[model samples]
Target chain A: MKVAVIQFPGSNCDQDALYSLREDIGVAAEYVWHDSTSLVGFNAVFVPGGFTYGDYLRCGAMAATAPVMDEVRRFAREGRPVVGVCNGFQILCESHILPGALMQNVNQKFLGQDCYLKAINRTSPWTERVEGVVRIPIAHMEGRYVADAETLARLEGDGLVAFRYVSPTGELSEEWNPNGATNAIAGIVNDKGNVLGMMPHPERATRKLLGCDDGLAIMSAFRLLPVN
Target chain B: MVTVRVFVNLKPSLLDSAGRTVTGALHKLQFDEVADARIGKTITLQMEKFDEERVKAMCAKLLANPVIEDYSYEVLN
Candidate 1:
């Protein structure tokens, strides 16, 4: 199976994403430029985290308007797998491929630390291998996920709640929340479950050098999808 | 000419932690009268004619996120 990692002008994690997927996970992944229109043959797409367009105006606001987002939308509609990390997540939300907008952190400060995440729904192919609670590293100044009441209810009702934050002990309670969001939501899937967006940088936690083991479990979720 | 104004905000279900913190700070400063606080954005664009669908598409495509935020544009002529 081929995995395509999108490379925007300012994407800093392309190498790391590529390294983790090809070297660590032993997957055949290629880098796709942000201006490309076609996304054929690739089974999955990864919008890695970084400051796209110098983060001018808003975080992902500029990148969302990029020329290639049209294909991103089409791929999402075709029930293909897409994951957005950090600023990538912002772009996806900006493109309306996922639910909710990521707002500034509650403290208005850039947070760079390891945190825990609970797999709220494992039904999706993206979460099938990850069970219970795991840890991932989150690094961003704007990572708060926000949505309206009715829309939030719809997401929950549709089993779109993918991953939430909790204590390292795996206690699925509100007290374990590291970030500021309802029920400490760290990640969520779109209505179709083909798109996954999360604040935590799984690419950052893939190696022991990064000081976390949570990323392995998260990436393993991709293996459940038949490699083609 | 038509002027379109777009309003964007976080959904009610999504927590406005930043707004909450600001409200908390205000309360700490003895501003208890502040019932609630929320943060959002607004933009205005001038166009030749008003098309609700096109305007909605613009908002959906760039101005605002339909998933986390709902936006409505007022047409002024």
Candidate 2:
């Protein structure tokens, strides 16, 4: 199935996502400009990471209102796969397509580093094949995730957490968290389990030549999404 | 025409990390009287007419993220 990689003006990771999807995963994926209002031919959508709209107003705020986001919202409504990475994640939250918000990192710095993550909810189609500590790079100024107490409880109770920061040994601890995200969360799935959002750049770590292949497992989930 | 000003701030329950950095900077500047610091932004709009309902809607829809922030606005007549 073909994938639609939504491209905003400031998106820098669209090419990386295309490369991983086409070269590594052997999926047909192409860029769809931000102003586009259609996703008819694509079965899945990917919102890649970048400082969209130069991060004006707030990270992802302007980009969330981009025309393509309406289609992204519609696509997600159709029970299809939608994965937003880094700034994409922020956009999703800003658009209310995802719960919670990505706040300034606890340290108030743009952190860029490889961090370990464990699949907290492997049942999701987005992370079902991903196992163990999946090392991926996170690059963002506002990557810390926060949600109200009621929403947090629902997420925890419903197994909506797709992944969580963890030590090499899969131990959850503050020391393993680089962004101070709530409950060490690295990624989360929508209630329908079709939409996934996370700050880590799985697209950047998808191949062996890139110095790591752990991201392949994550991509594989998107590639081999079940035909339900 | 009237002007409406909106203020947005992170919820008090959340850690204002940038605010904390400002506090640290202030401490280093010898402003020891500062207990804590919080940061927020203000936006002003010049409109043909001031509609409180529309302004609140704008705040909820775009000016602020209710998940992490709160917003209030005042009209300048």
Candidate 3:
């Protein structure tokens, strides 16, 4: 089960993802440059976090139009798992693989801290093994998730909400929402449940030396998915 | 040559923190008459042909995120 970690010009976390998948998760993984036009052999694609294209125009706007995205979209259509973290989430939204836009945090500040995320839906393979609330580190400026009311309702009705910010007691509240994301959403999956885009950096939390390894549950779940 | 000016703003339903901060600063400067302040972006594009449809497509596809923002454009020849 080989995974492909896409590397944009400004992607700073590609190596971290590669390490987490290759060393920590003991999975075969490789980096695919943004300009590459094909993604033929990989069973899964991981879009790691970073300031892609120096965040030109908008976060993930330019990177979303990269040559590799076309092939990424094709891979996604084949029912393969595609996970995006942080800026990766923005690219997914910009590419329309997921509904909603990640606007500037309501506080209008760059936030970097450990946040609690509740697994709202465990049906998807990505969250099947993740139980209840988990702590993950989030670092970003434009992570406030927003969508139209109809789309939001559809996402809720379809059970596409994968994770949401929650208090230490697992209750949802505005104060616990670091970015003021709508409904305290921290992550979401596509209608097919194969594509996942989330703000937290799971790769950064997979090692014990990093002070936490709670993120391994999600990665372990993803690693166990059947390859197509 | 035609110049297309695109205006993009966050939808009224969403809060604009940056715009609100700017409005607060303006109020402190005694611009008390300002009822409300909303911030948006304007992009000026130079095109060889005046193709309204193409410009609209550009705005829809890239200039603005339809999920959280609205966009309009004016063509100046």
Candidate 4:
């Protein structure tokens, strides 16, 4: 599968994402600048996490209006798969590509560690290859996901809830959540379930060097399912 | 004159971890009157020349994020 990882100014993790996907996962990946207008024939587009625009005007706010985001939105609407990790998730939220905005961590600290995630919608294209519950590393300060009651209800009812916080034993729990929340929702897919925005860095945890292989299952989703 | 009011907030489905932290802090401080606290920002900008379409463009393009934050403005001529 052809994968394109977007690189914007101040995007520090683009190489990490590219190396992991290309060398580690054996996926065809290229680093695309944020100014590009067309994604061309790429099968999947990966928005890597980083401090886009130095997180100056609200994390992903400035990066959302980038030239490439136009194409990103178009591809997303066309039912192509797009995966956003960390800051990429922030950009997606800012661009209105996905619901919910990432806020400051509940602990008010930059959290960098391996996190456990309970697979909420295993039937979706992003999680179809993953098992019941999985472990992945999440590294970010603005990782908390939030939304209103009506929208949250709609997302829950529509099966857009893709992953939730889980205990070490792989049991879902709201209290043990890294970020404070009622459902401990870690990640969510769009209404179409093709565009997925996740806080956890599956690319970071894709190899043993990163201390886990759980990301393989998540990244493998690209290979398992054809782009919708 | 035109006054634009922009309300910025976390989207309904995303998590507000910072909001929960502030609430917890209030409880720790023994503030019982506070039930829940969600942090948000409201900005009021006054323009000498009022153009609804231009103001809306500014709001949609720069002032607010339509996805996570909803913004509305009124013109006082």
Model 4 deviation from the true structure expressed as Cα RMSD, one decimal place: 3.8
Score residue A99 of candidate 1 by CA lDDT: 68
lDDT of 1 by residue, A1-228 (tens): 678899988998888888888876778889999988887888888899999989875678888877778888887998888889888898898877886778777667888887887787887776767867667888888887777777779878887888888888887776665557665778889877889998888877777776875687767555557754
- Please give the distance, in angstroms, between residue B14's alpha carbon in candidate 3 and its true position after superposition: 1.3
Number of the top lDDT candidate: 2
Clashing pairs in 2: none
The DockQ-derived docking category for candidate 4 is: acceptable
TM-score of each: 0.81, 0.98, 0.98, 0.83
- Per-residue C-alpha lDDT of model 3 across residues B1-77, encoded as one tens digit per residue: 78988999989978999988988999999999987799999999999988888888988889888888889888887
Which CAPRI category fits model 2? Answer: high
Q: Residue-wise lDDT of candidate 3 within A1-228, one digit each (tens)?
A: 899899998999999999999888888999999999988888999999999999988899999899999988987787789999999999999998888989899989999999999888789988887887889999999999998889899989989999999997899999999999988999999988889999999899898999889889888755688877
CAPRI-style docking class of model 1 based on DockQ: acceptable
What is the per-residue lDDT of model 4 for residues B1-77, given as tens digits with 9 covering 90 to 100? 66666566655554455687788899999997898787776767788877778877877777766545666665444
Measured with C-alpha atoms, the lDDT of residue A3 in candidate 1 is 83
DockQ of each: 0.46, 0.92, 0.83, 0.39
Q: Clash pairs of candidate 4? A: A145-B14, A145-B15, A146-B13, A146-B14, A146-B15, A147-B11, A147-B12, A147-B13, A147-B14, A148-B12
Candidate 1, residue B75: the lDDT equals: 70
Pairs in steric clash, model 1: A147-B11, A148-B11, A148-B12
Model 1 quality (TM-score): 0.81
Segments of candidate 4 deviating more than 4 angstroms: B1-48, B66-77
